[model samples]
Target: MTAPQRPRVPRRALDGVLLLDKPLGLSSNDALVRVKRLYLAKKAGHTGTLDPLATGLLPLCFGEATKFSQDLLEADKTYEATMRLGIRTTTGDAEGEPLDVRAVDCDEAAVRASLQRFIGEIVQIPPMYSALKRDGKPLYEYARAGQTVEREGRQVTIRALELIACALPDVTFRVTCSKGTYVRTLAEDIGEALGCGAHLVALRRTGVGALTLDHSVTLEALSEATQFERDSWLQPVDALLSTFPQVCLSDDDMRRFLHGQRLKLSSLTIAAEAVNAARVRVYSAQGRLLGVAKPGEGVLAPERLVVTTES
Candidate 1:
């Protein structure tokens, strides 16, 4: 019999930040490239990496939004993970071959107690299948060639690790942790404490900083939606940097600031008190975003000018 032809994926400009409800089985970068083509964006990047076995809120930044990736990356992340007990893998997830298996005798109370070990500030050694670099190459590359190397445990905070469900060999938990935490490592450690080996079977990121899965759209939906429809999903660039102080300029001040001139505030009419030359969000008199600015001695000096009066 003749082999059937595989269907080709269509291409389309993916701009702005896309809260991708990424499906399982695709790598984070894979999803980013796919979304990039959809928006025809000149540049694109992802806030964080999600394993192929994981699914959930993967924020894809396009165009000038890529510059804010560092802020998004530093934000805390939340995940809903399923840990399968009685077996351990080299990779720490289901993608690897089983290396060992232990008899499980874990109960709900026991599982909860075991998880407590991971809570608060702790150090964890990342798995071999991780993207952590060693001598300009990913550790997973060495792992594939049957090479094991020394990996130092780095400090990562586990703000909350609660057992959502426990059924002997299978345990589900919600972990709200700091950046760079590996749930797979936590799963293995939990299994070891319970006298059983375990590995992560499923994982889904529920939130990243302020962005949540609730505000995300799936790739399937994006593929069917038009450019105009897709553009509606973009939250303003300022939305990502809400932590900065805001400054509302008068009409004349806005004009002066846009024309490469500084606004001298001798009396300090800003809404924020105690402003001493810090980066602030600049907006027009009509409440339109102008961009970020740095305040000097009685003057508003723009450091990173984005939009101007013409814009």
Candidate 2:
């Protein structure tokens, strides 16, 4: 006997930003896939990558929101991290085998002083277990093969680093840093400063730019929410570009802008300083978001244009 097959549900055209509270033990992409399936969205992307060992706020973009996700990637980030002093790991986190261990004899004042030394621009050699590439392959591939490669030290800023608690072997801290800052490496450096090697045991991203963990929903919660409730969690596509200056255009200008034509600065309802800014959000006269633009010598050039339903 032949049985009829059920039809697959069609993916919907969804657009917005989701502040997902990524759970531990799942890679950022894994979490994204689960979220995508839950929403049945046609297009999706994440602003940054978080290791499986980390749990925190991860910004997700759907449809038009993906176009501006790069903005969030370049923004500063904040994290709450717990490092195990007196121990070093091959991967810099607890996921790897222990490489070394020493006595933890440092006090609160010493730990605070050690954190102060990292509160500014510093150079770091990217760990071999990172996603950074060398010759088109991830460094972790080389790491798994027991290979070592020469790496260059790059400059990164640590805007703020504060020790929250000093519990001998376990030290907890909060950090606010510029893009590309590696907290695991910071933990290792702090350990070295205290005469005891360390490795990150726990990490939680608290904030990215204007997004915070307070408003994020876990995958479990999303899975149980109604369709309308899931959709309610989505922020407008323009939410990612909230920090950028905005300019609303007339009907004629909106057409020209969408056509990839440059508009004169005088045509935009933006301040002189805003016109001088590198990037500005574009909007239609009807208050609908158009896209993003770059300020040129005397005009605003289209960079990324949003395709609205009406368009």
Candidate 3:
């Protein structure tokens, strides 16, 4: 017999998501770059941005996984925040210089009741010191130049806002809300509600979509662990996207799908309303993930096929 040949390793061995329990003092991008280095990932990006002072769940997408991040980014988020009342900062948090201060008396009941007023839908103007853009320049640039511009108020839904503790001017609260809701601005608004100005002192993201801090790993631990340990923390790319329906096809159907051919619906069942002419998860009959498909009317078309035969 001829000498046996060793198989070649794939160019990119890693793919999927990483739920990082980001430490305080690292910007979201900074954490992403470091994690990318740890995995030697060729392509990586975070689903959401976290401020330097905040810490908690930051989902990093690697390889083909980055394509699914948009949906995750839009998912509802939960946060635990501690705000210092009686003072407001220019950057809306502790990073900025103290802009205003006022002494005030506050009670726990009063604080809890005040938080109730902010529940439900409300309009919030983007802060000047934010990354919002105007004339192709970040609003923070204008803020640094002492220039203020008209900012349209955005409707943000707060699912729940509760005061966990109120010790004089320092108050801690938990908020579950839709995407785009700014916790820092909420803190300032809460301070205004309490007849005093306030700024965020400490804030941590507890959950994003279905991923939570409980399932996340710290950067330090991940850095020191073996590849097997690190890979265990990856949530399936589809785990956070269960709301979307899934469609599985047979081998023949998958062949057609790989050729970018559209087929009439038959045995597969997906939410009729969910099956628009858009991309969706595709799998084989054995429940192996193949890729995504675009379905229209009663026809299906493959978008990205992740099928593997040798595996």
Which candidate number maximizes TM-score?
A: 2
Which pairs clash in model 1? Answer: 13-39, 13-40, 14-39, 14-40
Model 2 segments more than 4 A misplaced: 1-4
Candidates' C-alpha lDDT: 0.82, 0.93, 0.84
Error (Å) of candidate 3 at residue 252 is 2.3
Better of 1 and 3 by lDDT: 3
Question: What's model 1's lDDT at 267?
Answer: 40
Per-model TM-score, in order, reads 0.84, 0.96, 0.87
RMSD (CA, angstroms), candidate 1: 5.0
| Tens digits of lDDT, candidate 3, 14-74 | 6688889999999999999998877777788999899899999899988767877887789
Model 3 lDDT, residue 20, Cα = 93
lDDT of 1: 0.82
Which segments of candidate 3 are over 4 A away from where they belong? Answer: 1-11, 270-280, 293-296, 300-311
Q: Residue 268: error of model 3 in Å?
A: 2.5
* Cα deviation of 280, candidate 1, in Å: 5.0
User: Which 10 consecutive positions of candidate 2 have the poorest summed lDDT?
Assistant: 266-275
